[model samples]
Target: MSKRLYVGNLNFSTTHETLQTVFGEFGTVITCTMPTDRETGLPRGFAFVDYATSKEAEAAICSLDGKIIDGRPLRVIEHQERAGRDHFGPGGGGGGGRGGRDRF
Candidate 1:
């Protein structure tokens, strides 16, 4: 099965092509994505890279974790899927608030 990795602490200027080139050295990259802020349309300083196999993914994690790219150390790890979390619907994660009340 394919493996997905979470790549964090990325430079704002990092691109998908750059990730493909760098990560491809270890193994075949099936897919790469760099998310952006919805409002500002700026790079979110993180990305997800999918490898064709878990072995390739582990190789990348061993070699590239903490490797500096664009002056920032990358945080590479196996991506874990959250269970039973519907983020697209209401009450997804809007918990823990004062509910318009103040502690005076």
Candidate 2:
């Protein structure tokens, strides 16, 4: 089956095409995407890669996890579903303890 990989610690200047090119050596890149900030439209310092197969994904991770790209160390791993759920009842998703008084 195809695998999705998470790449972190990316340089803000890196683009989806750059990532696709880098990972393309390992295997066919189905798609590569870099998350961006909504307002500033800047790289969020991470991205996701979808490879044609799980073996390809593993190979990509092994070859690139600690490799430097654009002067930053890349963190490549199998992407897992993020653990963020709606934990708050009202104003949701802020930093820090969930039960803390709103001081910000």
Candidate 3:
């Protein structure tokens, strides 16, 4: 079965098509995607690549991880499921607070 990997520290200029092309050297790329910001629509400096098989994914990671691309080293690893964090602070993560005060 195909396996997916998380590719971090990617150049902002990196594209899904480019990723597929680059990683294709290792094996068949099922899919490639670069996460982007919703507001600015900018790359999040990371991406995910799905390979045709786990062995291919491993080979890609071994060959591409820490490899230079766009002048930066790539970080490749098995993709992990995301778990929502408790972004809420003491009151909340919104940073709502009183006026500035010099409290000792």
Candidate 4:
């Protein structure tokens, strides 16, 4: 099964390509995502990397965790799913607005 790993304590200048190149040493990197702030559009100093297999993910965690890159040590670990949350974020769907209530 594919595995996702969370990479934290990253430098602000880290790029998606840089992550792939670094993590690719262990195995195939399925995807790399670096989240940027909505307003400033700057790197959040963290990233998520998905490997083609669990073994590949493990290899990366073992080798890259605490490894220094760009003057900062990396924190690599298996990604955990947040309870009661999805890609769109928390809460159970329908929100905002007056729920069809006539505001007169």
Candidate 5:
């Protein structure tokens, strides 16, 4: 079965292709998604990588976790579905100001 992994602590300059190239060393990367900021349209410093197989995902976690790239250590782990209410609230959007109220 395919496995999904959460890749954290990514550098801002890291790109989707770069992630594919790096993770591709272990096995086929099914999909790589890097979320971007809604306002700035910039990388959110993390990505989700889906591998073709569990073995490949394990290999990537073992070999790439804690590996330094662009002066930042990579945090690789199995993706887990969030439970309960999202900490970001209803729309999963940012909570600004006090008590989840918008300051603007």
Candidate 6:
């Protein structure tokens, strides 16, 4: 099955195409994405790379993790799906402050 990897500690200058080129050495890179700031539109210093197979992803993790690129060590690992929870805070609960329904 296809696998995704979280690539962290990327240089701000790193581009999606650069990630593809780097990771492509291991296997087919299905997709590469580097999120940018909503307002500044600058790289978020990380990326996500999708490989055609888990083996390829594993190979990438083993070979690329801790490797320096653009003067920053890369942190490559299998992407773990985050657990479903509240968007606000812990215990999936929120909005219990002075401005809430208890306000006089």
lDDT of each: 0.94, 0.91, 0.89, 0.94, 0.94, 0.92
lDDT of 2 by residue, 1-104 (tens): 89999999998988777898999999999989888899998889999999999999999999999999999999999999966676665567667666556756
In Å, residue 79's CA in model 4 sits off its true spot by: 0.3
TM-score of each: 0.81, 0.81, 0.78, 0.80, 0.80, 0.83
Candidate 6: count of backbone clashes, pairs at least 3 residues apart or interchain: 0
* Tens-digit per-residue lDDT, 1-104, candidate 3: 98999999988887777788889999989888888899999999999899999999999999999999988899999999876666663444575676778754
**Whole-structure CA lDDT of model 3:** 0.89
Flag regions of model 4 displaced more than 4 Å.
85-104
Clashes of each: 0, 0, 0, 0, 0, 0
Q: Give the TM-score comparing model 1 with the true structure, all chains together.
A: 0.81
User: What does candidate 5's lDDT look like per residue over 1-104, in tens digits?
Assistant: 99999999999998898899999999999999999999999999999999999999999999999999888999999999887786766776765657554745
Best by TM-score: 6
State model 2's lDDT. 0.91
Off by over 4 Å in 5: 84-104
Q: What lDDT score is found at residue 28 in candidate 6?
A: 93
Tens-digit lDDT track of model 4 for 23-46: 999999989999999999999999
lDDT of 1 by residue, 1-104 (tens): 99999999999998888999999998999999999999999999999999999999999999999999999999999999877666686565765767465766
Show where candidate 6 strays beyond 4 Å. 87-104
- Measured on C-alpha atoms, candidate 4 has an lDDT of 0.94
* Superposition error at 99 for model 3 (Å): 13
